[model samples]
Target chain A: MDQERIQDNIDRYLSGEMNPDERREFELEVSQTPEIQRLLDFNRKLYKEIEVWGKQKLRKRLDDYYSAYLEESDLDHDQAAQTHIADPIPAVLNKTPRILGARWWRMGIAAGITGLLVISMIFFIRQQPKVELTEETPAETPVDSLEEIAPPDSLQGRSKSKPGKEGEQPKPQQSVPGASKEKMLKSQPAYALSNIKRLPKSFVRAADYPQQLQYTFKNGMLTLYGDPLIPPLRLKLFRQKGRLLLQFADDFFFIDPTETARPLIQIGPLSVSDPQPLDESIRIRLANLQESKFTQSDLEVWTGTSPQQIYSFEEKNGKRALILGGLPEGENPLVYVVNGQTCFLVLGSSVFELDNAVNQPVVLRRINGASSANARLFEGSKEFERKVYKIQ
Target chain B: MDDNHLIEELRNGNEDVIKYLYEHLPMVESWIQANNGSRQDALDLFQEAIIVFYRKVREGDYSHDSRISTYLMAICRFQWYTILKKKTKQQESFAQINLFSGQDTGNSSGEPKISQEELSLPSRESYLKNAIEELGEKCKAILEAAIFLNLKMEVIAQRFNFANAQSARQQKLQCLKRLRNKVSYEYVMSLD
Candidate 1:
């Protein structure tokens, strides 16, 4: 045969495009001709290698997905720990009654004493001259005036300083006590100094904010910095194949401090797109079998009508065995070997097991059960189709 | 997603299935670690079992009678058992050797020789891999699209910017021919 003819025949045979008669003839030709057989064997090996390559690609993808999962899980754990640390009141409340009673009595006595001192101080202050009170008011005046005049952007450059340092440069006065610090910072932009306490202990405030809020990470703890009004943008820290990455939104950015010009190099999205739709013919065939209710009588009728459908039936060692066939060519029964024993046979997308001890009827019921389950899968596809149609 | 939907996704080589499959890893890891295997061993073995499971699903052999996790665990256990047996045999063989003796095994150099696993691969597989690699990137892409992805000749043609389906088919055949020549030459050379 010419090379072209040989290639064509081999493609057809391997692709299962040839009918049984054609396949038999081709096999005969192959067996007789060593050259053709050798070529055919090579093609088969090539196809197998291609399959292995595809599986390796899948394994690589799985590794990535697993890494992403681990990162997210770690982030969750840290967040949970932070939440626990934020609220210690419940834990205190859960203490033993004897310890709680003593602590509560002590707190009550301290509060009474504090209330008496506050009343006496108020009376004494009221007795003071109006000029003296005015002199003290300037100390608090800088904070109120700064809060009114300072633009939100100016807050970024305000470094921590002593209370009386207002004369040097208009900075946020640290002298304010109680709610004054919170009130002052609240008027500022999203990355206020007060918000620093909200961050995890491992994250150090960035030395300079050239742009938006930034933090330098100490440990592997992820640093989240964004507008408090809106939801905080979570940047998951991921270590993949020895390279550090920060996942923000749908994209992953490489974390390399050395690359100061572009510290975060944009890596492509980590998520894999949904797989392509299954083969149309396979889908249609599966859909058609959605309502098939196979029973013992149905099996018997199928066997009687077409002997070829019954792949094989034999008696060995006084034990009868039956193997149902008549599936599409190249789609043989799927033998599921579990625990080193063939436990299940999935034929025609329906499952059945071979048991010599059980009668045919019992085996038939099991087949029926498995077939019904298989049908349900198709039913799910039908529901999906309906949803798609509705959307259209 | 349900098991059936997951199976369908797996058949299409979807990566999302990996996340769902990963949930079962901790179980396998704990089992392997308890059975005198390391976390790395568990990971490698789990990946292999998943590949086997994927092949089975593609071949239409996997039945929904059992859950995917149960099936995976069974495969892992079976594979781990096989590995343990091999390790035991290797240990027995090592036990037979007298390391305390002053005699040298072979070379004077203390450095360990590269094992077969460290090499490219088995001779036949390496030959095939090298042949495919020699086919060049474009040819590999064409072949992968045509054979692995099972794309139509027309689709392959458009994808590779060929003149038409006929040209694409011609290119594919040409690539295959080159691959075959390389593999055959290597086989002939090896035989000689």
Candidate 2:
């Protein structure tokens, strides 16, 4: 093959258009002719070389093109640009007196809106049916038995005593373990937690916590708040023959008076007792004095049988509602004893919500059970209506 | 260095364009030297070719009908050939050519034959470019359109307003011969 023909064939091959026969013939010529072979090899090398050089040259060209342009382009101060963006803040601040005046006007509008909202809330709350506390008489307490002790028929509708005026629930009765009601009364003015920082003097060495012990001798009611240790553990102190009880979800566990010596209500993890042991646990009655004043009908039924069988503090309305059964599997209830009067319980879902984000109540239920053990909350439509409580 | 994103940035006239070019220039210059030319020559040639390409492109004379590389290479080819032409003319000797300019122009209906001695020059890239630079403009354009752009001989003939591809091919051969002569002269000069 001649040098020119050979060059053409190499170009054809590079372009991927060489016919098979042409390729075979070209290969034969390369093998037989040293000069043509060398030329073809050189052409291949140059084609690759030039293609690379071409790109590099273009890139270098592009750079040079821009370098000259940029030096003369006239758009270069980013720091000044930042100052311009930030200028709005000072501009807003320069109008501060006017803005403050405008803010006062906004405040007036906000107050009016807030007052309207409060009025609307009052109306909405009044519209809701008054949650009548059901007073179920025990099998033995005949109606005639307590007729002399009972209040007039007009007050009979409110079995757990008449609902107090708005924001005027029964004041927590102050009853320390050893202090007499009269001494508790004499110091009541000082012990009363008008300021949240002060604890009632009844607690021997009350720690700096917002805990107060209120004991009502007339109703045998005791309320606690702040650290669980302020008041004795036996919440049944408020009820007749009241014992220290732990309610977990719908499961209830009685503090074994035989096993547990220290009555100071401690908030922490609860041990798991055998399910059967819990079943056999004795159910004690509220004190006779408390029972005599309020019939079994007036007593709120509490069945303390949570599925996990652990204990947590729960509050319903203003009353401390110790739960026995509404616990989620694999977890225990978080108990909060507030001022020794109310035990505020957060269920697992509620706990999870508080942990994950700002929480909103998703579903609400009203459950009532015996001994606080029968009441349980089954989440996600489990369909077990064993005394559920409405948590608003 | 040939990152698609950088190419995009360059096209968009981004502020980083200057820095990118500065960093890449030496590498590009080195690559050209590795490919064929000496370092200094490659740098000068590449720089000039790029500036010409950039000027034409910036002026919008480059329609982008062909690749940026192809356009730039065309400029590089012009610079390379021009340099070779100047060099060859300075040396005086008997010039050799690979093909006759009028052989394919309806000469004889037989196999186009070439002798071993006549076929001794390197491929067009190795020697043909220098040889072709010595040819007339008609031959230069004909061969350039055919070889660089890979235009069909008929298309090249049409593009140059020639009679036909056979005639175009005949013209292309004469161009190849002229390139060989220049190469022969360059070789003889180097021997001295």
Candidate 3:
């Protein structure tokens, strides 16, 4: 009843319809009585409560709207650049802004940056010296590999395998944990293939990776970005007009490359500056030995015949990983960049963007065109180096 | 449009007016940067100022005699002062900038004075902010419509599917009452 009376009195006071006696009585009650004063104060300051609440709601809505606008602005900036490219060229001085718009000034500064880069590149290339082989250099040459480092005693017993047709996905190189060391070595290279003459569908190759693995290729290297939680992927990629289109299903996302991978074969030209789309088909460009044989000093490092084959098979509790052994320091295959760090390997590929740069471990079989030596080695996990020893 | 028409449009809850105020935010940036504030700080305070202006106009507490810039700058100054006071906990001298020139800000609503109750409880604002945030979606929308949008009771009723304007009004009051209870209860608990 008191709450009702208080609410009624407050309404009557605010409405300004109270008679003189009622008004005088209400004022006197409010002035002298603490409870009445408190009630009046709460009623009057309800506006203040609304004011604060409105500010918070408005701030969030505006900030989100502003960020989205900024993102759209970035796209507009890109389109503006494309427009300039399509338009006719004006002399350098004519391009200066009469009224400085945001886009114009931005493009002008970008042009200045490009000019600076060209001048800097000229000096950098001229001053750079050729790198020479030294005692400090690891993997000086593949020729002296067997002579310097004795094979791991575990791999002393070795044998070659019967070769299969080219382009076959090598069977899983099983490690029999219960088998004797001698038995394992005798059964080494269990399924041999002359060459991995073709690349399989991305999904087929992707089966070998942890389901969380995401892959993209740049500069002849296939990078596998990792998601800690391994959330469901909503990836979209398609070939439109010879341009490979890549897009994400959602706006809020990030790709963390836990490890990067590529084939260890370093074929002709090293890396193609402009690699064409390769999803439709795989085209292998065999190295031109007559021209590229002595053109690179790396080839001269290996003048001798092929070294004796060796095999080391260690299996425990069915751990799945390709154990990369018998690799000499020089011409180490596999290159990648993850989280701003780039590790370059002599992964044999004439072109990168195309299907030529093989990231699947199957390519490790046919690397160096040594089909007989392949079907033996495979790619290892990121922690492979830590688990095994490397020749110092 | 002219300033009078713009103000009128703003009072009627035009989005373009808000965008116009933010699109040309160099003055706010300059003032914030002149103090020890970043561009982000300028944007945040400017947003608050705009909200305050919108509320003042919607509540019919703003006088038409004062320029919009004067009123906005007043709000910005007050926001910055509040931020600085919270940061230091002690009274600090201001960096010299003409936040107000004693010109007519057209403030018919009583001065946005500091309440003694607010000063007495340091954690009150944060608690109020939290309680408002944790409110159910229905309560939030209803309160926002009643208080910020200041829609007609019938319009609010239509939007929320209420039987009548009176029911909508009752719901709005209940939400507000719930929020107040939460804010004060949390504040007193924290003090103890």
Q: What DockQ do the predictions score, one after another?
A: 0.08, 0.01, 0.06
For residues A309-357, could you state the per-residue lDDT of candidate 3 as single tens digits? Answer: 1122122111111222333324423221111011112222310110111
Candidate number achieving the greatest lDDT relative to the actual structure? 1
For candidate 2, report its TM-score.
0.22
In candidate 3, what are the lDDT values of residues B1-192, reduced to their tens digit? Answer: 445677788766675555555544556667767866656456656665665466556545455332455446544544454344332221111111112453443422112223344334336555555677788899988877765555566778988999998788778667866765765533333331
lDDT of 1 by residue, A275-326 (tens): 2322221111111111221111101111111211222222211112333322
Each model's fraction of native contacts: 0.20, 0.00, 0.13
lDDT of 1 by residue, B114-158 (tens): 333323334655666777877889888877666544566776788
Candidate 1 lDDT (Cα, whole model)?
Answer: 0.42
Superposed Cα deviation of residue B83, candidate 1 (Å):
2.0
Off by over 4 Å in 1: A12-23, A74-392, B56-62, B98-127, B134-175, B181-184, B188-192
Candidate 3 — which pairs collide? A139-A330, A167-A197, A263-A347, A264-A333, A264-A347, A265-A347, A265-A348, A266-A348
Q: After best superposition, candidate 2 residue B178: deviation in angstroms?
A: 3.1
